[model samples]
Target: MANARKKKRADIPARDRILEAATRLFTQRPFDEISAEDIAREAGVAHGLTFHYFGSKAKLYEEISQAAADRLDRIHLQATLAGSAPEKLRSFLVAHMEEVHRRRVDYVFHSRGGGTAAIQDIWERSRSHGIRLVLGFYGVTAPSLELAVATRAWLGYFDELVLAWVQGQITNKAAIVEMAFRLFPVAVANAELLGEKNLPSV
Candidate 1:
């Protein structure tokens, strides 16, 4: 039995085994209901080993979410078509939505209410990075104050809108993207009119 256990242990890398088990569990169960011991049992590892590697259940979930986001980021960065801001942003958004649609489990897990501080950190960082990406694509090296404010507001709105689309609360994804497209100018106009307070961070 000892030799059998050792041989089985050698069959899978520790972190990957733990992550695979956790991913399966996360897909089936709510985050709060899951425990480290449950993940250890599912991974066929010693209960303490989950803590040894991940420190906490929250951290494990954060790592899983981050890994999935990294994969999608790689896909989104791949330039399928080189063109102006609209063309590039549209291609990027299409790729992003497709990746999120494919990884609906991770998308739902990351987006909804059951989020930790670690997850919130990821979202905050993503918001900043998204603004930078848009500014680069639009060739706006020195964005005005209104443009920055509007972009921030647009990102906040876009995240919620995409969440609704993912949850099937909104059926028209094209409309979601279409609205996003129209809102760029609207956000700017509102920022100009309302002194950067109208569309204030969704």
Candidate 2:
């Protein structure tokens, strides 16, 4: 039984080795430039095993993107569950920026053109989950149409803000956090006006 378990554990490293090689290759060059053969050579695995494990390069890219998105989702969920709207928002921004900094390579890959359709879908879903959590924390519940519009606008704003920060247009993380903090009250007020049906008492 112990030998069997050891054998299973040994296989996990090969999978991770492929992923690591792919990640490094993707970061160093354009997605089109990196071939499965390159990845197999870098990972020290048979080329066939790359296809066997990940099906295709596109699929492997999707898996990497999904993993990163999942990490971000977990961070946001943890922050939300820890405190009130204001606190949650602060923690969420901090955690998000920190994650981006830590996983900058993955961020770069997603920001680039390497993402597969499945990866794009997972990212969109994760974003929606974050926005919904924020709305819920603020006790906001508008009509479905209005909520959709507002959420879209808010997400666009959030995306722009993060992109600017990532591109070095914004240097101070604390300043960005402060700006986010200031925006929360206005958002909450707007929610109060638009979402009368589900306003929680202060």
Candidate 3:
């Protein structure tokens, strides 16, 4: 049983290695430019193993994209929940900027594929989840349709700022954050409007 468990642990690394290689390739190059053979060569595994594990290049790309999205969501959720609303907003913005810097290649790939059906579906799912999370942070028990529209508008502004920053249109992170803060007075006003009984002082 010990030997079997050890072997199971051993196989995990190979699977992770494949995923890591695939992620690197997908982010660094266009999807059409990356092939299963390239992933297998980079992973130092047999070509057939790529198919054995991921079935196809498209599936592998989808899996890697989903993994990245899941990781970002987890980070955002944790940071938001671990602090007061103001701190949460600050942390979320910083975290998001850091993540965009770290994952620029992934961002480029998604942005460049804007009109692709697969990318559109992924964006829709991610956007829906993001909207729900933002509503939770605002502490709106029953947000009206107008509130939803406002939230989406605010989120779009934030996203555009981050994109601009990432693309070199904005030079300073602190300045960008400050601008975002100026535009996002809702974070402060929401605490009062929601009647959060024990709101922390910003």
lDDT tens digits by residue: candidate 2, 9-59: 567677898998887776566566789999999887889989999999988
Q: TM per model?
A: 0.77, 0.75, 0.75
Off-target runs (Cα >4 Å) in candidate 2 are 1-13, 23-33, 108-114, 140-143, 188-202
Report the poorest 10 consecutive residues by lDDT, candidate 3: 193-202
On a 0 to 1 TM-score scale, where does candidate 2 land against the true structure? 0.75
Score candidate 3 by lDDT: 0.71
Predicted model with the maximum lDDT: 1
Pick the winner on TM-score between candidates 1 and 3.
1
Candidate 1 per-residue lDDT, tens place, 100-164, comes to 67666556766665678778777567656667667667566666677787788886787678878
Candidate 1: the clashing residue pairs are: none
Tens-digit lDDT string for candidate 3 (151-179): 56666777777778777887788987777
* TM-score top scorer: 1
Better structure of 1 and 2 per lDDT: 1
TM-score of 1: 0.77
